[model samples]
Target: MKIIVIGATGRVGAQVVTKLASDKENEVFAGARTPENVPNASNVKAFKIDLHDTKDTILSELPDADALIFTAGSGGKDLLQVDLNGAVKVMIEAAKKGIDRFVMLSSRDSLTPDSFSGPNPSPLANYLIAKHFADLWLIKATNFDYTILQPTALTEKPGSGKVTLGSYSSNENSISNVAAVLAAIVQDDSTIGKIIEMSDGDMAVDDALKNLI
Candidate 1:
């Protein structure tokens, strides 16, 4: 598989890119706004990409990719620009290019529509709303293979080398554990079209997803 990872410089995206690139079965394109921050992977090439660009940075960097994984997110200033519109831009480009597999790294807050209806949510909540819209757009945008991984309260917990995948639950997971889940989803064909919510668990990432429909 030829995979492209947006936000490859992020805390979790770095792990995902490195894991995929090390697999002999996959080749990786690591895209970041600052290429220097992207980790060096043996089978990966780094590219500088601004998701906020109108010209479609993802399209330009990964024109022939088989799978596109979006991990980029805007924290405070402009959630509408980076998370919503930026993600939409990539989805549009994916549809135009016929990319088959799309994986999105979303937040657990996206599972609840009321996340934005609270009494003046924090800036981070608004960011989650943007991510929610991105997931919705991808779901409605194409018939190609897709999966959304929603994780809660990310921690720095060392990936217990395991995870639990299902619908939105009250369970929480660490960033490393979530990274493990992303790695599994990218390599598994059976996980396509599933919105999987995950948490730290006793089963390995691959095993947790093995029985996932």
Candidate 2:
């Protein structure tokens, strides 16, 4: 399988790239705004993909890929542009290019009122609003095989190699564990059309996702 991982320079995205590339059967391409910034790996190739680019340009840069894993973000800035608009644009291009599978890295509570944890107008609110719409667009506006992973606040701590899926009590997840789930789902057809909410837990990553609805 040929997969393109957007935001490959990011913490979670880099892990996804490395994990997928380690598989001999899968060809992974790391996509970033500045391709040079992506970590070097023998099995992974880096390419430039600006979400804000023209549709044609974006499509041209993206090879004929079997799936697209989007973990891009603007780091609390340009939520509307990079988070919402950029994501929608990539979805559209994926449709045009016949890329069937899409895996979105979203946040927990993005679709619920609880997303706005703070006051009415907070940065977290804006971020959740952007992700909410992006996830909605993927579900309602496209026919692609899509899996949305809504994990809580990400941490750099070593993964427990375990996770809780579907629901969780807190909004905290290790980046490695989240990446493990993403790598698992990228090749698991059963996960198609599923929206999974995740956090650190005692269940192994594969076992947790196997029970997804």
Candidate 3:
């Protein structure tokens, strides 16, 4: 299977690239604005993709693939440009290119703009609002078989390959664990059209996902 991972140079995105590349049958195309930072490997290839570029340019850079995983963000810098509109642009391009599978890395409470907690009267509010609409647009407006993974409080802890899904998202979610789940979801068609909120838990990752069915 071939997969394109946006934000490939990012923390969770990098782990997803390496994890996907570990599978001999899988080929990973890593997309980043700064392509040089993407890791070099046999099954992994870097491509130039700037979310801030023209929509046509983004489409041109994105290669033909079986799936797309969107984890790109501006770290609260350019919320509208890089987070909301940027994501929608990629989705539009993916649809134009006939790419049907999509996976998004969103945050906890993104579905509820009011409940989302961040610094009082800060970008966090707008970030959640952006995510709220992005996820809604994917679900309501697009025909793609999409999976939206909403996790909370990403951490740097070692991955235990354990997680809780379907329940509300809350925990110190390790970036590794989140990446692993993102990797696994791309290969599982059952996850299509599902919105999964997850976090650290005692159940194995695979097991937790199976419970979703």
After aligning candidate 1 to the native by TM-score, how far in Å is the CA of 2 from where it should be?
0.3
Report how far off residue 102 is in candidate 1 (Å). 0.2
What's model 3's lDDT at 174? 91
Task: Using lDDT as the measure, name the better of candidate 1 and candidate 2.
Answer: 2
State each model's C-alpha RMSD to the native.
2.1, 1.8, 2.0
lDDT of 1 by residue, 1-213 (tens): 888888889888898888887787788888888989888867888888887776555576655788888888765567898889988888888777888889999977685777777787644677777887888888986776999998877777676776767753436677777777887787788889888877777777777788676
Q: Which stretches of candidate 2 lie over 4 Å from their true place?
A: 117-123
Residue-level lDDT of model 3, residues 49-154, one tens digit each, is 9989999999899999999999899888888888889999999999998898999999877887556654564346778888888899899989999999999888
Report how far off residue 194 is in candidate 2 (Å): 0.8
Candidate 1 colliding pairs? none
Deviation from native of the Cα of residue 16 in model 3, angstroms: 0.4
lDDT of each: 0.80, 0.89, 0.90
Model 2 C-alpha lDDT per residue in residues 63-97, reported as the tens digit of each score: 78899999999988789989999999999998898
TM-score of 2: 0.94
TM-score (all chains, Cα) for each model: 0.90, 0.94, 0.94
Please identify model 1 stretches exceeding 4 Å from their true place: 56-58, 118-124, 167-171
- The best candidate by lDDT is 3
In terms of lDDT, model 2 sits at 0.89
How far out, in Å, is residue 8 in model 2? 0.5
